[model samples]
Target chain A: MNLLRTAREMLEGTSYTLGIAGRTALALPQLWRRRRETTEQCYAASVKLIHVIVLVGAFAGMILSLQTGLALADFGQEGSIGSIVAAAMVREMGPFITAVILAAAVGSALAAELGTMKVSDEITALEVMSIDPVPFLVLPRVVALTIACPLLAIVANVVGIYGGSIVAESLLRVDPLAYRETVYDVLARPAELFPFPKDIYAGLFKATVYGFLIAVIGCSHGLRASNGALGVGEAARTAVRNSIILVLVMNFILTRVMYT
Target chain B: MSTAASDAGAAVRFESVEKQLGGKQILRGLSFEVPRGTSFVIMGPSGSGKSVTLKHIVGILAPDAGRVLVFGREPGQLSRSELASLRSRIGLLFQDGALINWMNLEDNVALPLREVQRLPEREVRPRVAEALERVHLADAAQKMPSEISGGMRKRAALARAIVSRPELLLYDEPDAGLDPATGGSINRLIRRVQRELGATGVIVTHSRSCALTVGDRIGIFEQGRMASEGTAEEMATSSDPRVRIYLGIDGEATTERSDSRGAEHGTGATGR
Candidate 1:
């Protein structure tokens, strides 16, 4: 019952603050005095994106190579390996892997930092000063997350494809030229890779939606945290749990609409 | 800052106000007027709804019943812009100071002006400097809240409170956690500001010296009501047990004196 009540309150708070954030976005020019290219913000976001892309991309690729090799060997067509790996990474694994990485890394950080600020009365101080914190704090994060995540997925796709290529050549004794040719041929097909413009669009849309969800949960939980150390930990934990769940749920819905 | 002190009007007024939290009543039918150009202290022990009353003035908490009028307009009913205007006109000093630890003292104090007004750097810089000077914290303007002493942070928070030169001021335990000397200085500064700017104040404090120095007419909170009110002089002289106890006077000594005086006068006027 207590958990249910807390969830209800968190939802209410998120919606209320999001409405305020919407209004504040309209008044951005004044609040953001130094809108002259936020290089530091973009740099920080890029570092987070790169870290996830590299780790998830390499791991997914190695698993795909090993498993696909064994499975395809039974069918007597292990030569289809490169095409299989390339297609899977671009269409399915890339977006899903990227979202999960963000949910754990960047999303959790947002919750922890904003949560600490909230518990420390920073949000209240901003309100007292007539500075609406929703826009000042949440908007930049949402924008950064949305723009960075999709780009990171593209990078993950390429890196994962390379990882599979390495295994095919080094471990599986497949000719590098043949593997490259198969990957290129499979990826070149518009239908297999793109499917529909809606597929790519849906992935991007999901990224943005995930961004919105993460920021909302992080900020709301942070702002309403209890007054000390334990409060900060709770906010971070709640943000990560809620954001990861919401991301997977959203991805499932988007996938159904795009593929099924 | 100088121009804001020029306007003269009733700073804040509460008419039959009521507040409830979690289905429990915090304030019940509170009605009062705080005239401009003086300080009025709300005296009460803990859990007396003092902070709730202050929040209503800033629209942080809305009264469930009755009207809250600030500068003659209902605070709850005001449009966002209007509410913003009213808030900018009134300065609130929270009990915890509510300083933004991320920002240095200058930025924290400059936050309101930067948000509410589109003033140039030249204009805002002087005001920030002047505000810091008023709180005797001009030296610590560039220091973060973490780097400053507790007393200095409180002073910095006070500087933030007054940066906009508000016509009305609210202090939520301004002397809380300060040493006797620092607390006394805070009281004197509050009194001095009340005189110089002629800003009406609602000070919520536990300090006896704070109430006596800052409040022209003090209200003693009790039994879900303002049980009694009078000038400091009248309250100091009152034989009421609640008043006597709060004032730290000998309860038995006052009771005996009142009894003897009542017997000598052959009346019950002083007996109660």
Candidate 2:
């Protein structure tokens, strides 16, 4: 009986998520209609995270480069650290790390905001005023996140590659000239393994999909919130947890589809 | 002292409506009507489906059984655009003000004008100022709702409700959690707005003072059903035990009171 109940809940949750996606798609035109609102939301979503993104990206790149360089040293392949770090950052860590940060910060904020509105009757007020809350509230947040994530991921990629270079020069003692040459060779060579630019494109695609999914999860949990303050808190907690798990899962699937 | 039916002149009418929420029956065979250009008050204890009934009129919730007609059109039967059009003609003041916390008082009141009416900023500004002035919150227009007092918040909500000059107004406990003086003033403002706009008004309250003050006709709800309905005078002198108990009137004492005195003083101090 418990298993059946759990299965029913999972089905309901999936159906609800799909329904929100369809509604969000239909409400896309609202982004154009409410351009100022969309822009403001985009600014709010992205502006405060610049410092955090830079720090996380740089640290991730340094740590990955150091670990990979140490492992390769035993095999006398330490000089190849730049190529490996750049490829991994471009293909996976950059987008994944950025997504995790945004899921915790912006996604949870969206859920809390909409949940409070639900509890306060503000969403009902919009309905009473004949303004659909999906178009008025959800559309702007989704569009803003979609536009912000790719841009943030680009920043993460640059910082991560720079950090990797620094670590390679300082800790690995790989010749700076040799590291630069390998990075350029990896990115510039069209026939290299994993190829030039494909991994970068894959990273950007993952970022965009992650952004869209995070917004959907946050908004859906918010709109479904009931009970009041406790309900709002639960919605925010659920949004963050679900978004992180989905991002990791999606990262794997996207990697398989892109590389294989 | 009977269930009012929908008439050609009625602004809102509920016919044998029933609603269930969370596996609990909230409204059971409920029925009432508010005539155009008059105030109809539904007085009931808490959890008696008063708010649910108001939601049905706005199409926020649909009835599980029976019909809700607003402006002679069945709300549940309307298309999306039709419902939007119908809702634009109505204004609702929620119990807790329900102001958007992100926006300050002026912007909150101006939202309907800018969004629903699609008015320009220049026009919306003056209209917002006018609404604030009417509610005596003009000086506090720039302040957030949290910065204001409870009475001010309620007044701000009232300002938003009347800003668009809606033809129908629904107020959910306009005087809830208010002191008697403040509640009285809010009731008076509601009456004044209704008269000035010549709009149909429906108010749900548990306060007999509020019902008698604003209601041209009054309906009492008990246990998700309309127990009885009548004018202020008729309700005060009603012989129904439920009505007597709900009104807090002793049957013998009410009988000894002159009909004129009951009618004159039935609404308490706010009536004048």
Q: Every model's DockQ, to 2 decimals?
A: 0.41, 0.77
* Candidate models: Cα lDDT each: 0.73, 0.84
> Distance (Å) between predicted and true CA of B180, model 1?
3.4
Instruction: Assess the local accuracy of residue B100 in candidate 2 as a C-alpha lDDT between 0 and 100.
Output: 90
For candidate 2, give the lDDT of residue A159.
Answer: 93
TM-scores vs. true structure, each candidate: 0.84, 0.91
CAPRI classification of candidate 1: acceptable
Q: What is the TM-score of chain A alone in each candidate?
A: 0.83, 0.94
User: Least accurate stretch of 10 residues (summed lDDT) in model 1 chain B?
Assistant: B263-272
Error of 2 at A254 (Å): 1.6
- Which stretches of model 2 miss by more than 4 angstroms? A189-196, B1-8, B237-241, B249-272
**TM-score for candidate 2 (chain B):** 0.86
